[model samples]
Target chain A: MNYPWPDIGTPLDQVATPMPVIDEDRLAANIARAQDYLDSHGKAFRPHIKTHKIAAIAHRQVEAGAIGINCQKVTEAEVFAAAGFDDILITYNILGAAKLARLKALNGRVPKLSVVADSETTVNGLDATFDADRPLTVLVECDTGGRRCGVQTPDAAAALAQRIAAAPGLRFAGLLTYPAAGGAAEVEAFIVGTMALLAEQGIDCPVRSNGGSPDLFSAHLVPSATEHRAGTYVYNDRSMVRAGHCTADDLAMHILATVVSRPAPDRAVLDCGSKALTSDLLGFTDYGAIEGYEGARIVSLSEEHAVVDLGGCAAGFPGIGAMVKVVPNHTCVVTNLFDRMVFHRDGIVTRVETVDARGTVW
Target chain B: MNYPWPDIGTPLDQVATPMPVIDEDRLAANIARAQDYLDSHGKAFRPHIKTHKIAAIAHRQVEAGAIGINCQKVTEAEVFAAAGFDDILITYNILGAAKLARLKALNGRVPKLSVVADSETTVNGLDATFDADRPLTVLVECDTGGRRCGVQTPDAAAALAQRIAAAPGLRFAGLLTYPAAGGAAEVEAFIVGTMALLAEQGIDCPVRSNGGSPDLFSAHLVPSATEHRAGTYVYNDRSMVRAGHCTADDLAMHILATVVSRPAPDRAVLDCGSKALTSDLLGFTDYGAIEGYEGARIVSLSEEHAVVDLGGCAAGFPGIGAMVKVVPNHTCVVTNLFDRMVFHRDGIVTRVETVDARGTVW
Candidate 1:
């Protein structure tokens, strides 16, 4: 459990290469900006902790006026719950007996714990696990445009909500949808239709949740959504910048790496590869972007070496032993790769926080 | 760390979804097969622990006649070393003062420790850290055909080897190359030429190492290489099967996941996603190959959901709550994503071993 992090107040140069570092100043600003933007629209903010997976960062988000936090897995919620956070929403279909047992226990401890279900199987499992005296809140997951999970149509969503409401140990909490990149209009139509159907059935829906980092600022576009959920906004990445959601200046996480080998005039190898960065391309051809090295492309990634083609760069390739900062294509995946992340301000280390929920994918 | 693993003799049906499981019979067979194959060719075998990152598996490889263990990072080697492993070879350029200090400490404890270097910056750091009384063994890494973290030519390797020989606290060991797929001729040529140059310089080349799982059975092609190293052969993956190295039966590792959603007849969603199975496509278009379900493609993966397309399957898609096994594109990266791996025999749980170096990327 000993993380390879330098002491507090240590300079960035003294820290090891291929390590995840967060700019404290930028991190605070990103959290505050997102909360302020959501507050302006009178929308409740529930920042997803999957991006950082650190309890301290989640505390900052809650302190910045977030109503609750979103977790992807049962064990991830347990981490933050142990760290003293109360409100948690797990936006995943909780299946199987084992996970249901854990989820029931987590619900017993947390004040307001909510989960989403898209099918009868998930609803049955949740109903079978909870007791009548303590009903677990359930949200119907609707697939508006994102074709990953959730019910196909608003009618299907209304049916699932009725099923949840009829269950003895489950209470129907409104709707949840992880929309496609620019599918706000579709999300709005689906939620509106589902709500109308529920009205006809005499079911009162309270929470309407919608989220996606690619369309964070435009979350207000979905007028029916009451709360917003987002994970990637905590640490903006190359894909966020490409989506025009956040600029490079708002990027908080950077992989500090050393140029270990210069095998060719146009090629250099970095110590940070797929293990340090991530293989999640997020629609980018290259692995990541070098901060100051414009046009340099990460051609390929071995387990521990990132082969960069410096041919596109107007400036020459970095010499061996030189250090470079790389902005990962997807910062959330990068956060899960490490056990701890170093927080810094103006290139000086402030503290190191353990990624408590890293590898808690189950 | 409390990993979500079931007890001994637990049924596969009882275990949690999105968990990495290894068939104990197949794992033992893989270790024995690779050892016998290398033994028949009169070549020493060094199993890279980066694939499993478990001491029990490393111990099994040693019991199966592996000469030593190979590590990619200093902290990873320290993990195996603490578990009673000696004679470790770290195949990475040891740069920076902090890592060199660690390398020196590891070398002091291990009976025999070696490292690779392709630049003077690495060699100088080693020389500055170690004492002359107990010099560290250094190998010159040649690029051969794998254009990553190595000298481009035999001459440059020879030059680096000579530089290591002259260093105060370093001993030149030999040459090492991680050849490109099917690039045995280039590897042989590079090693032969480098040995000749070292002979002319009166520098003794004791060991020559060459390896890659794709070209594992063709180790004899590089006759100059005294030893061979391979990691993925221990748990053959989809990429290894496509490379004609091992069959589907040789794939020991699998992500046991639950079918959480069946939104469309052609589309089913698995609980496992990029966090369970890696996103390393290698050269495959799909994320992974689903066992028992031919022509099913894992079209996309979110952090917690794997959207599968069963359109091409002759059989209908699996219903919600059904379990499926996934063979990842790259097994090594998959191993890095989990804290513990479940070992089973004939669909019955045997034990769960901790991935000791799970996140020791530093």
Candidate 2:
């Protein structure tokens, strides 16, 4: 609640174990890398705000050449909108009266409000919500490879987009899809195929957008995609390292964790666990990595502590009151868990930003 | 983020859709069942507050005859302290200067601040920060089948407890262990075994606590356990249902989500995913059940949308612009993701409490 406690009283140092420490300089560099990539690609960067879920970072991103911010939920968009982002894109399939109500409310505030929808049923809902007076711009999402959402066939995509246009309150804006890593070719084919289908039906498709940090480098090859969304470039994590996007040293955010117990000679305990780091079951076995702790994998996670299991090879970890910077498996969820994060630049405390939309779980 | 955003400003009917909705009445019943079990067992119910992370709920738990609240982090304990909780037991291996500084700050507020450590390394850290005057309480955490933190042998437990007592500013309280479900015999043996060693060493043992929700129903069989810390009883989840702790209806919390997309004829998508409900990395395949969809499993989850593999059962689902409820595998992690949650009695919404210590990453 009342963070950093006021007591914990003064400041902390490298020895100050167990608090998320963001190396601001590294964060800036991570941000610059994303900017440089987008700049090189000549693509509009509407980074997903859901990743960092920090208004401060979002503002910095906008300043660094992002066209706007894309959020996964209306609540997140609303939080960002309230924090003074004029242009916001909700990169989610909007549905229902509740979602429409929030969208209407948000639409009144922000200058540009764009949303993506996959099905005709969602289009009808949008039609009912927006009517002829305020025509809602709808984008048909295609499930190129990630069989999560969107129509499969190009004909289905065209039909869905035309159906949205046929609705009194909804108009076909373009095509939108979120492809998985190494999905640029697939996304390009889907967009091209869907656009050709729409053109054959005498319907025009303008905006084509697709994005993910791992694929951002290859995004330039997809000429039809005018907009790109990437979230993790600002705070590169261990996954980014594994993905070959960045080196481990390039990561900006690191969980400054405290070692509580070395139960065995090998197992060193840290105060961060699923509760803090989040159990984002991201198809992984670990929550994070304790820097310098070799052969140690975060084997188990309780709500409080991450049980680091070191089989055979053991090192004398930072004794009892030792603090180690842990680079979480994923940085986005970790940032979303906190209300405020203290920034550090060049090993000196810079500033703290309130994660204004830390939790808008609906 | 202002939640419950409708597509067209229509309020949702609480009963219209299926989800893992928490019935306040059911929650009361569940709490009653737990307290009744502890009362029948003559054990103090010091609920592990990690499940709820809400101070109001914790206070309500205390009002319902709880001896105190058992927290796992100094941050969690600080929240309870701020809420005017006098005595709090942090059942965690607290470490580092930053955390100890926080504990020292908490010591000034809460009268009784007890923690557990299984090793001399951990106890020594306690001795370092305790300021000597505060007199922090420590307990030996013995491994009693959970295979997590804790000393492996009772002899080691006694040795650690002695080391804790001998360490300046640390007062050895008793023995603590988190037993695997129905592992009371192991807990009893450890406590008795450790106590005998303590007596042989001219030591006095007072409190002996064993905690874990699944074992609450059968905890008293461990004759040496005086208190129990059970968190999930406050808000049972889908995992608890699968674990035989509660019925599906006994769950006290649900993600209020809107059906944003109908990606396929059979598959419908909801707006809540790993971000809202949390990807708790549960062993189960289903994210949660679609409230009323008989045998419908949410087979896949992305960051935002959960692709419900409807199995050619589209006719059973609600229209596109509809709201639906879904139960998450783990409720505790989901609760930790939010700052405040609106409570409802019947269908009418009521109060909102700041999840006072929702996201304490440290």
Per-candidate RMSD, Å:
1.3, 3.2
Question: Ignoring the other chain, what TM-score does chain B have in each prediction?
Answer: 0.98, 0.92
Per model, state how many residue pairs clash: 0, 23
Candidate 1 chain A: worst-modelled 10 consecutive residues by lDDT: A313-322
| Candidate 2 chain A, poorest ten consecutive residues by summed lDDT | A5-14
Report lDDT (Cα) of residue B152, candidate 2: 85
Listed for every candidate in order, the interface RMSD values in angstroms are: 1.5, 2.9
Considering chain A alone, report the TM-score of candidate 1 relative to the true chain A. 0.98
True interface contacts reproduced, per candidate: 0.68, 0.71
Error of 2 at B8 (Å): 21
lDDT per residue for candidate 2 within B1-362, as digits (tens), equals 44542222223364222223445676788788898888988898898888877777877788888899898877778878888998899888776555778787888788988988877767777888885777888888888888777898988998888888787788888998888643677788888999999999988888998887778787878878888889887888777888897888688787776776676677777767776777774578778766788556788776677878777466778766677777778888877766565555564544556677777655
Model 2 reproduces a share of the real contacts of 0.71
Task: Please give the CA lDDT of all the candidate structures.
Answer: 0.90, 0.76
TM-score of chain A of 2: 0.93
